[model samples]
Target: MKLKLNQLDILLEVAAQGSIGKAAKALNLTQPAISKTIQEMEAEIGLPILQRSSRGVTLNEYGQVLLRHARDIDRSLHQAREEIDHLLGKAMRQLRVGFTSAASYGPFTNTMIEFQARYPGVKLVAMEGRPHQILDALQNQRLDIAVLTAGTSIVQSGMYYEPLYALSNTIIAGDQHPITHTTSLKSLMNYPWLDWDEPGEHSILAQVFRRYNLPQPQNIVHCSSPWVMARMMEQADMVSMWTSVRLRFPGYNVNLRPLALREVLPATSIGVLCPNIGRLSTAGNTFLEMLRINARDWLQQSDAAEMVARV
Candidate 1:
């Protein structure tokens, strides 16, 4: 079908705003003009794209399909413009990245610093969120890459995961916690606990308790924000499961200490996720290379530290 770019733009705006009136206001047009554009698009496509109701307009199945393609086209056009501007020396290069809390505590931050040093003109936009949030942004083309912890079985079809390093989970408690020196997992049940796992899913801490045939802590608070969790753990008598690497960080180490538990928690893989290889911009490719180099150096250093500890 011969649909104009403006038609797609109207459809996207309407879907975003949830009504023709709101879309029109945002686009600086009248409600009827937006309605007519929608009607024209539907007539050209020979299908109803939206389902109208008393509340607001919602995308029908056909509209959902079309919206996906529309978003892809929109992203391509934006990327094309950016590329052309860079070629003409009218704009600086930019890269958008999303990362999880765990990734931020490790080599990812170092990689970003190294990238910035190498590409001084490249603008780096980094966002921190949960793994699912980061992955969603990457898939929607809002982000060029995502750094998060994932297992091998958690792969997505159109994404490539380049593993950086393995991270071990550890139990942490504030230094002043009553049972901070306790080695028994059962002792922790008497105090309140903090968990970062999504509701309805078994957390690594729960799994560790299960492995020992111990009952799960009853008074547990579920949270996903690392900053909140850290503050709560420091001020309250709460225990949490956190990455060992993070526990060693300067800010975290001030108040939090890894519990000396004999049980070892399973390690998870931290990696960089992106669209299929060879699809990134020049700046993105260079950043990815820096990540690889930093990750390699971090792993070797970690191994040497372990050897020294053993000796």
Candidate 2:
């Protein structure tokens, strides 16, 4: 069956919004218009796609399959447009890169600078987002490469990843926080804390509590931005866990200090998540190589310093 791109787009939007009226509002079309489009698509395909009820609508089995192909088609169209623009000399070679908030503060910044210097004609589009959002973009082909904290789910998602460095997370607070002087976990619990906006079951804070056999800390604030967390700690008697490396970045709350704990949290893995390396554009591949070199250099320097301190 032949279907128009607009029809497929409408169907995808309806499935996403789960309400015809909401989808119409989002797409800026009338509800009747949207209904007609869906009807036409169903007629062309010879099967019902959506199951409607009093509450809203949901995709049936057929709708699921159609939505998946629609997304693939959308990606292809975007690539085709980019290619045409490039051929017309209207677009520069572009590499879209995404990074988790923590990844942005490190040598990745230098990698971007070096990549730009090496390929002066390439256009860079960098974004900072949570790991899940970055991963979604990578899977949808919206981003060329993403650097993020490597988690089990990321490794299991079937994406290609190169481990960059290992980071140990520790509780941090304003340098002047009274708890910084306290060596006991009990004393540390007296202050309110902040945590990343993650599920409690999967949170580093929860893991710390379990390790110490302590009750969950009270008066906690959940924040998503590392900058927000740093600002809060600078202004209040709050605590939160972050990569030790994150705390070391210049201009990232010079007043923040890692709490001295007898317990050591497991190190987190940081990595580059990407599609097949062979599929990346020349600009994308060049930037990826720069990332590898920068990561290796920083990790080696850190190791050397640690060894000297030990000696």
Candidate 3:
């Protein structure tokens, strides 16, 4: 290709920072040198890639196209380095994995435990975040794999989502809550509710109330931290949505119990999202296999009603 990797690097930096001088400083190159690289690239391409302005430079259509491939090339080059190092016995295999908050309730940690016991040399880095955040990390080459629910989720190009299992969620409350005794959508809404603070997630609780033609609850508490929510559930009359497998994870107290309501949340797909199976590193592929195997067992053992209590 006419555009060298270093030139593409400069272009990407300039696009991100929006200033040639900033890009030059970041790349440890002189301002004129950065300009010369762009000039050379434009000379070869026979068109301008950036729109020069007094404030800063931005990528034009041509520049955006080049940047898309540039990022891909950069990630592929990184994978190639890791592959070469592993083959040379210079570095141990590493797997970077991420999961959404809902997926944390699944058997991800158990699978990781078994995988680590089996492959002592493979390194694992795990992260938990929202679905969009996980997908962003995967697309930015920060994470090798991500497991999340496929419900009104973002779908990016060049990324593949493999459905692993069907997942469900439900509302949970402390045993002290009055709604626990007399469970009704109206009665459940009477008390303050706690839920995830993720804006991208579908408001299943709100949707359920709306489906019943009831006014939306006014007393709602949104929490981003599951630990904080659990604490609140133990201390106060708070209700929140939780996956059936949530009981498998730690930090939950005996005070919490699932509310048997006639209305249940919609089901979603629990699956693995990654770049490409063929491009996955040795450890990455192995971890993906572990997820698949564990997901099958989890789905088979999980009772449908326990996860999603539909009337």
True-structure Cα RMSD, model 3? 16.0
User: Can you write out model 1's per-residue Cα lDDT over 1-311, one digit (the tens) per residue?
Assistant: 98899999998999999998899999999998998998998899899999999999999999999999999999999999987757745223788989877787646888888888877888999998777777778888999888887643336535888877767777888888877454777877888999877544336567678878998889989888766888898899998888756765557778777788767567756888987666777677777888888777776785424411121
lDDT of 3 by residue, 13-113 (tens): 99899999999999999999999999998898888988988999998999899889999998999999987867845223677889876676646766888
Q: Which pairs of residues collide in candidate 2?
A: none
lDDT by candidate, in order shown: 0.78, 0.79, 0.75
Residues forming the 10-long window of minimal summed lDDT in candidate 1? 302-311
Query: What's the lDDT for candidate 2?
Result: 0.79
Q: Once superposed on the true structure, which residue ranges of model 1 sit more than 4 Å away at CA?
A: 1-92, 156-158, 180-182, 210-215, 302-311
Model with the higher lDDT, candidate 2 or 3: 2
List candidate 3 segments past 4 Å from native.
1-92, 155-158, 198-215, 251-253, 302-311
Rate residue 72 of model 1 by lDDT.
Answer: 97
* C-alpha RMSD for every candidate: 17.5, 17.6, 16.0
Candidate 1 or 3, higher lDDT? 1
Candidate with more favorable, higher TM-score: 1 or 3: 1
